[model samples]
Target chain A: MMEATNAELYRLVLTDAPYVIGAYAILWIAFVVYLSMVLARMMRLEKEVDLLESAVSKRSGE
Target chain B: MKQLRTAIVLVAIGGLLTTAAFLMAFFTAEVQQFGTVTLEQEVDTVFPVAPDQFQPPAGEGIAYVRPWFSQKIFYFHVPVAEASFLVLIISAVFAIRFLTSKRAEFDTKSRIAMETALVFVVLTMITGVLWTRASWGVWWEWEPRLTTYFIMMLMMIAYFVLRNSIEEEERRATYAAVFAVVAAINAPISFMITRVIPSNHPVVFQPGMASSNLLPFIIGQIGMLMIGYGIYTARMTEERLRERVEIAKEALEG
Candidate 1:
């Protein structure tokens, strides 16, 4: 009887595990993705300014 | 640079705390029973229907103490939802400040805060749906709390749309600020709807929680707030960088 009860509880846990896991996964993934986007934007902006400076300097020399 | 470093530090600490809370919620905290399940009517549940232990008789069955695995969701959901609301109010406060002072910085701050609020709100909605599915056996429902929160999300989206539709900076900022304040109004309404009106969404507030449960919940709340602040600050730094680039570009052209 005890083993059967434990088995039932385990089944319930497995059933609900997806939703719980999904929630945590979504939360963390969203945070990491957003942070990465911000970092990517910063890098691109820095690169753009660098290229812009070089282009202007090259034109001045020409 | 200094601000970005501080933001990173906060995010690291916040991430660790939230992760700790998540772990504690599963291993240390005791799950609360919202209510009992009865076999009187056909109901969808994760629990075994009329298990041997819960089986009363063929004709009649009493209410069973079915464990709610979804109760674990409460810790994270409550904190994220509250964080969203707090950030919305922050946006509105900055919006009001911008309207009064006519400062560009305040407008930017309001916009960033709104962005952060939207992110948290989306996270809340996702977790909320999962909770509903796990606990209530529904993927979506037109309940009061859910409906109010959906409206709040729409309002936040509309605020940004209003900002983009207008080309003039000052006019756009003014309109978005007004919309921000209006959207902030919905935050409280949505939060209170679960208590004020009859709703299936469990109210985690009002004491009576075991210290084990409360510890993870409190930690999650503080962690979420710190995360929200870190995201806000980092985004602000990025905005400042963009402004500098714009200034430099114009200087070159001139």
Candidate 2:
């Protein structure tokens, strides 16, 4: 295998072992956090939709 | 009930096959011989494997022959990568279906498949990173294959991001499906362009492996595909049930 000339770039970024692992860890954590937020918002919207439907039903019955 | 039963059966088969492949890799595969080097060489001097044993130097263009068991990563890596792409395609298919039919079920299937693809894509990245570290002495490289997979990982994440940003159910489904289809198209092009473009990265596609090596790889591939299918089916069933429950609740309220 030919040595990549740009191997120095990797060496520079990975100077600290923790940083390299941390990059991946951070990305995953962010993704999960974002997903949870989305799910929560969806649940809230569903509840609001239900409330609106119920309110309309009550008005019709009266 | 029938779909659940089918899913269970598929998962069982996948589990059995994967276990068999794992055993075959460890006990049956022949050790791949990386060429030997003298202890006094400059390359060996820099990247010493042990205090006494001669090993190739790090970052030197020397190939350290990996043990037979080291090859097992190949089985795991390729299968996960293949499965990831397969699931991506399935997601795209459902996305297209949703776009055409405007059906909730299609959207549900697309989302579940995307979720499953994410799992496999992560596995592929992990295994690919390990393989690069072990074989190439680098934790990460911007080589064609690596770069392409990296882009793919990001694209899939972006799909989720796009989905999250949308508040409306139908609009979110439509946009995510469109993105999924585009991503599915891009991944193969990424792979192809990487291979075609000339670069310094080492290509490891050997002409042929011994039967022992081949057997495990084949088993692993089949097992992974089966597992992927099983996961998709299981998730789809769960989504269907959730939709049914949602409909029932709405009906009761009505």
Candidate 3:
């Protein structure tokens, strides 16, 4: 009886493993994607700032 | 500039804390045991089956399936949901401030806050859907809490769409602010409505969560808040820098 119950408990753990792992995996992916997007936008804005700064300096020099 | 640097550090810390919480949840947290239900007959779950239904009959006749894997999701789901609501409230607060002051800076703050809120809302929805599938054995349900949350998500999307449809800057800001305030008001209603109306959503805290569960949950919540704040501040910095560039371009043209 003890051995049968132990086997049942082990099986339950295996069955539930996927759902638990999947939730954590999806959350990590979501965070990474959001971070990547913000970084990309920041980079684009940085490039724009550089161009604008150069243009302003050229205009003042002229 | 200093604010942006601080935000970056916060983001790093938040990410690390959340990762640690995830590890602790799996390694340390106890598997939840909500009331027991006995299977009357053969159920097709991968979990070990009782050799006979009558071999060990539960007193209530309802069989508690093995403590679910879905319970694990609560750690992540609850935190994301809370963070999303907090960001939305922040957005609405800024909206109210913008309306009172009629300042473009406030409008900018409101808009960036709204953007951050949208990202968190979407994450909440994704996590909620996953929980629904794992817990309720369905991918989606139009149950009270679910339906209310769906409406809240739509209102969020609508807020942005409303902003886009308008051609004038100030008019767009005003309309978006109003929508944001409405959405913010609706958020608490959507949350509390489940209390008044009988709902299927699991009330996690009323019965009490295990202390083992609470540690990771509290850690996850703090980390999520920090991450939310970091995202908002980072976006605001980028937006402000873009505005500066636009001003520079205008000055050169003049």
Please name the candidate that would achieve the greatest lDDT relative to the true structure: 1
Q: Count the backbone clashes (under 3 Å) in each candidate.
A: 0, 3, 7
- For all the candidates, what are their Cα RMSDs to the real structure? 4.8, 9.2, 4.4
Better of 1 and 3 by lDDT: 1
Model 2 residue B139 CA deviation (Å) reads 1.8
All candidates: TM-score: 0.88, 0.69, 0.87
Fraction of native contacts (fnat) of each candidate: 0.40, 0.01, 0.49
DockQ for the candidates, in order: 0.35, 0.06, 0.41
Ranking by lDDT: 1, 3, 2
- Candidate 2 interface RMSD, angstroms, 1 decimal: 9.4
Model 2 spans > 4 angstroms off: A1-62, B39-69, B199-206
Q: Which regions of candidate 1 are displaced past 4 Å? A: A1-5, A49-62, B34-64
* Per-residue lDDT of candidate 3, residues B1-254 (tens digit): 77778778888888888887888787899876543445444444444443345356454223434666667788888888888888889889999998998898888888888788788778777878877877777889888877887888899889989988998999998998999999888678767877888888876556566788889989988998999899888888888888888898898888
TM-score of 3: 0.87
lDDT of 2 by residue, B143-249 (tens): 77778778888999999999999999999999999999988886676556646887544343457768887888788778878877876776666555555556645
Q: In model 1, how large is the Cα lDDT of residue B110?
A: 100
Lowest-scoring 10 consecutive residues by lDDT in candidate 3 chain B? B56-65
Which RMSD does model 3 reach against the true structure? 4.4
- Residue A12 lDDT, candidate 1, scale 0-100: 54
lDDT of 3 by residue, A1-62 (tens): 22234345556546656776777788778878887887788888888888998889988999
